[model samples]
Target: KSLTSAGRTVLNLALVVISSVAAIGAINLSTRESSDSSTFLLTADVVAPTLTLSNSYERRDGIVLGEGFYNDWGHLAEIHRSTRVEASTTVDDCLYGWTKVDTYGTETFTGYGDQVEMIFESVGWNGISLLIKCPSTEQTATYPVMVKYVRREIRLLNESDRSTFFDTLYTTYTTEQVDGERAYGKKFRSIKRLVSEHLLGAADKECDHWHDDAGIMTHHIAFTLEMEQSLQSIDKTVTIPYWDYTQDAYELDDWTDSDIFNPAWFGMASPSSKDHVITEGRWAYMSVGKQADTDGVRNPYGLLRSPWNTNPTPYILRHRYVYDEKDGGWTLPGCTDFSSAWSYNSLGEYFDELNGELHGPVHIMIGGQWWVNRTMNFSATNGGDFLLASKFLWRQGYVRCPELCSDDTPDDRCTCSCPDELTRYFRTSRDFLDQTGLFNLSDGLFSDWSNFATTGCMTPDDCFDTVVKALCHVGHAGEMFTSAAPYDPTFWPIHGLADRYLSLKRIQAHENETILSQMWSYSHDGNSPSDTRRVCDWSKVGDTMGLPDCYVGDCAGHRAQDLLPMGNFLDRNESYTNEEFYKFMNPRNEELPYIYDSFTQWPACTDQAICWWNTDGAC
Candidate 1:
């Protein structure tokens, strides 16, 4: 049944009007503003590209509204707080068998180690749907997880106002349960129960109260893994399975610390979505202690080498750890877990003791959790999985493994225990206080006899001051002072006044070694001629573009294609996977991760050509 020309024209006109109305609906939703003066709005120019126009309205801007309407993975903010769990292994069964004239005791042991570690972070929006991508593994079978999420004061801006709104905006999307399936709904309820137990206001079932708030709502998602759950395993996989977004289900004021930082705020990649966004899209910073140079030997310091050394390389920063007495020496109260937070908290306390509590913002060390994705090296539970303990091992030289040590053997080894590692990680945390003369100790350049006037210690009383200077001379030496020295310690021990100084030097030296090792490996590994840049005088084939001479050390010889066309990150340590390279080399019809802005969109390649090329290419 073919329609006449008149009927066809009417249908076409109807379709255009419907699309326009839908676009308008999307705009209206995004433009809901707060009562405060900081209310957000979307500008005409910014959203015009996402909208379609009707015949009566001119399509001057060609805006296609709702294009970015869904809160996809790329633009969401991550809120993280430390959490913990406990697990223990117990003997399963025992039996006795008679042999000859004697009865022997036989034992069948099925033990489960109680798992406990700070669930430091989670990603999600307030009171919205959440999906967890639990890797498929044997451990997840027994202890189906009871995950929790907590949302705090942070608001998700409903921006429809300003030009910059779209740049920073994120959307919230939802999912529904299948017919006749109560299991999915029940599982989601279990997750909420865990959040209630650990977080405030969750117990009252008041999470829905957040809808009444005047501004954007923020709900944190948290989950508790059952004893059978193995978070570090590759085979274990789990998703939110379901969500309850009723306004009454969330209570923002009841949110606490644990509630503020939960993983559901950020979603994992779906089977059809971009892998990089779920696994490694955002920028994460690594804290490199002194092990940057260490070889096969992996001590406490070596733990710092995890993801960068094992997974695809990401951005990295190498610096000394600072110590603070306030945060209880990097130990969070009621939680035995150790992390960068413990270090920062300790430093904050230490500063307060010396300067009576700092009055302003403090720079804190950060370690990203994307590396915690099951695909990376840190996911496994092994003696060497701890960076905090490893840093201590490197600092103290050696000690019996605390988590894996034997009670029968005397706990004696040069190797560092967990506490010692925490100590080492905080090496330069006090650089600011040490340089401000709070403790009154001065050395090196400042101690120069010729520079008595500048040292501020020329007087008899000043000469006796004894505060050790920080590892780096990075502080402002004050207005009148000049010749502020850089903390390049040539000689300093791990103890006494020189401890911080020595650690700083050791870290730098190690970083240099990491750079050199990777450079050499990149140059010789031949499979991806495109992977290794021609940092040297080596000639190129085709569009083999190398980075500028500025990358002499770390990123030397790497091509612009090696860096750009994916993202413009400056971290040299992050490396591309073999699959990524195949797609890059042959990108015409190839579904590639590099093509769609972030690594999330890059599709994994399976070309036999790539396999043969890499194998025979020998790189």
Candidate 2:
């Protein structure tokens, strides 16, 4: 309708004010909707889900290689709008963007209920990628984990690490491969071949090079390292975990109850099988390969070779038991006081104690024999057989026939009353000698007996005493008891402990400014004269004992400078001299590439006045 100018102006002003209020109201409505959208983003699939590591089982330093790390991801579901969490060891292009996913590594993600565990498997810089996704869009988080390569204590190893180790060990042991021409002749890459190589070092004879001498530490160091390399070839993460048996000896009331004998570990220490076959754990029903014949041919019994039996069956035997005399299990020395080894003025003394006290007792503990009474009748005969019986009686301390003969006659029909111990020894010795063709009637009993009798004796009484002493040495059973100890899987861990001891000794020597190379004296038997010949002096072939000159065929002799008998078992490209092994024995050595998690603790007492329990208090 037509109106005056003033009325129209007033109406226009009023209309302008109404329009401004409506515009402000529209802005407020838009802001309210935006707030509602933000709430929707919190509850729905608008923004990416937050991903984080709520908890991790890794040490503050770094993750252990092969051991792996456990991580919890429950915090990723903070928004909880159909959230998804995925983890991978490998990341293709996470640097480009969080949503960009491409490739994964060899290690599979293992976890349950918003958690993930992963093994790096290799040393050095490794990374883990986590991808978190809501209903729409995804975010990624990468963690740089440094993995350490080291040999750890068996008891301390996690389930995954232990599994990896055993898996690699069993694979390496079982996987057979023929070797090309190298040291100690060509052979297969199997435990059988390892046993054969060890057998060559001694061959069930008194005269030997590798054992009970200064060379023992160096030789076994090389042997065990070679074995470790073989296992590493399969799984790069695996290191031979040392079983600190001293822990068992000192910590436990019954060492047999150690977790090392659990099914997940080395298995049953005492098997229930009549054949002594291990029937539980990872190595259950394992075959030891074919037993070699008398002529060293791989024929006859498809089992481990044993001097106790001519036709040994296919089985790995263990006779672990407590020696009644000790009241406890076998006492493993160097529990708290490694002074027994480190206190020695010379390396010779240290090695002597190591071999006799530490090494030999373990073998006996694992493979010692039980005495049992048995009655048997023997029909007397003349000629070589009669001479054999008489020789046996003489060796057993029955100097005259009257001492042995129950009928009180030195005739062919004379009956002998033999002690069970002596009888068992005689039978085992005779059978072993006969089977191995070491001694027989054809060799002329008088001459062979004379050589054997004079080899380790000064007189007839000395000879008889030597025979009695030899009984304790040879009364053991099973593969570990013999020179062919590598046949038993337990041999590796025991030797690993020995290696650890070697490392400790090396460190102690270094601290004292005494090099192992400086101390050079070969004392196999305490009675035997010290053989001061250097290993480089190949002219000296025989051992300290004046026994037959049967030395290790490949190596020179027992000295720090001697070339280790690597044989075909070790890599030919590598130079494994005794000195090289001596250097490798140091855990801190750069070339060693690995270190132990911990070492056997030394005694707290630094001086006589400082008692262990009261070092910080009044004496």
Candidate 3:
């Protein structure tokens, strides 16, 4: 009674033929009997509908999470035509149903349509299914999609992304976590703890561990990653948005007028009250726990010697430039400066220029010269003496000499000139005085005006040492001026700019086929012999480097292989070596989870002919 294989195929074909004939006959009969008979019948088509994706979105690998795709309905559409067709009818015109099944296995009935948009609220693989229905049967097709995380410029973030970023940052800043069991289980890991780590690394007097060395880029890169990772723990969808100050420096006449200082952004550049506390912005009314003493020093772990009272002050202080064109002495580097900085082929020279010229300037401009109880004036003195005394002040835009102006005055409006060596003296003196409080009037270099006049320090090095030693004793500066600069929120974004520059440099170096490991060595002489120093030789890995006395960790030598001394402050079980930190300096590194948006407005490299790594001076 069983049928053979060929016979079964033949019988099925005959059955299909008979079904088609019956369907036609039923249709004809229904059409003829519709007037008097309420009952009418037609054979249902056995063929099922087919579903497929439209060509538009099929080529894309994925989309960024949190940024949902619009017009996605057009991307998923029914493409199959019915096998059963009439003179004017086809399955193409039939309505289709759409349903979305997410990664959680939750199904949602989108609607009855040939096209339906797909959206995912979470990151990773998401599934969307489409169902098409013909007269009798239905067909379903599923598409798998990927969603990823991307760090965008603060300005480019959508409303949802912006909210999430701020929310996570605020939450991390406010929440307290246990640091250690010592001192009654004292808590940490708030914004204060994060800033304290920066202070510990940068303010330590025994070692120049973080700044002014080859490790500057890598150390700060690791530091920033820690801060970002802390925020991401609360919400994995959030990424820290970078502030590209170069855009403001180039596009705006006055960089302070940038919208980044708006209330919705970082905050106003200048505080509205005398306390120097920011009153507007996402970080408005925020208070920090650390305080600087009159000596411009802070205890990395304990209560600070408060400037006003005996109690530690819990306030974030900023002395940013007032929002007026007249306050024009301090400024962010222009596009031309950035262009020149980007052209350096040697990592050492590039790091030196960037740290001194770009990074240091932002800190100075933001924190300002610390609050001085007294501002000395030599205007009442003779013109010659005034010119001599004002040389440093005038060049820094802190003072203007109207009496020295001539009919043919230069564009800067004053024609008085000082020796280039003295100018270097002033530059060194400003930085030395601001950073280290080691200067004193007893040095006899500037104890008296007559002594300054008779000092015959016309050469650069002698004048620099003499002036720096003299000024360091006289003035103390604000947060940004010292190693405790992280008390201000502006410090983060300013350092973000530094990180961005490193990313740019790494990209260019890779393009040129340069060896990254070879570029880690740098030699730097301290401002003074007593100042902290770092002279790294990449080839000499055995050489040891000193760490601060406050540091209780293992030794960190002056080589790329040594561990960063302050890595423990991030509360990680394992510390990162300089080489390990260096690997992630480039934003494009696979291990780095986030990427910076394009620096579309930054200047192009102009010194193409100069090869920085070429010792023989050959291009």
Could you tell me how far off, in angstroms, the CA of residue 174 lies in candidate 3 after the best superposition?
2.9
lDDT of model 3 at position 612: 33
lDDT of 3: 0.45
For the record, the alpha-carbon RMSD of candidate 2 to the native fold, in angstroms, is 20.4
Lowest lDDT block of 10, candidate 3: 78-87
Q: Give one digit per residue, the lDDT tens place, for model 2 in 243-299.
A: 767666666776667788897787877676765678888888877775443443121
List the candidates' TM-scores in order: 0.19, 0.54, 0.55
Residue 619's lDDT within candidate 1 is 20
- lDDT of candidate 3 over 283-354, digit per residue (tens): 776765543333333432233311111112245555553211112144676555665665566667666665
> Which residue segments of model 2 deviate by more than 4 Å?
1-148, 178-188, 204-206, 291-303, 306-311, 321-329, 334-337, 370-476, 512-517, 523-557, 567-572, 600-619
Could you give candidate 1's per-residue lDDT for residues 339-445 as a string of tens digits? Answer: 11112222222222111111000111111112221221222111111232222122222222222222233322222222333324444323322332212222232
RMSD of each: 29.0, 20.4, 16.8
Where does candidate 2 clash, by residue pair?
A: none
Question: Using lDDT as the measure, which candidate wins?
Answer: 2
**Model 3 stretches astray by more than 4 angstroms:** 1-148, 179-188, 279-285, 290-313, 321-330, 373-476, 513-518, 523-558, 565-575, 599-619
Clashes of each: 106, 0, 3
Q: What is the lDDT of residue 149 in candidate 1?
A: 22
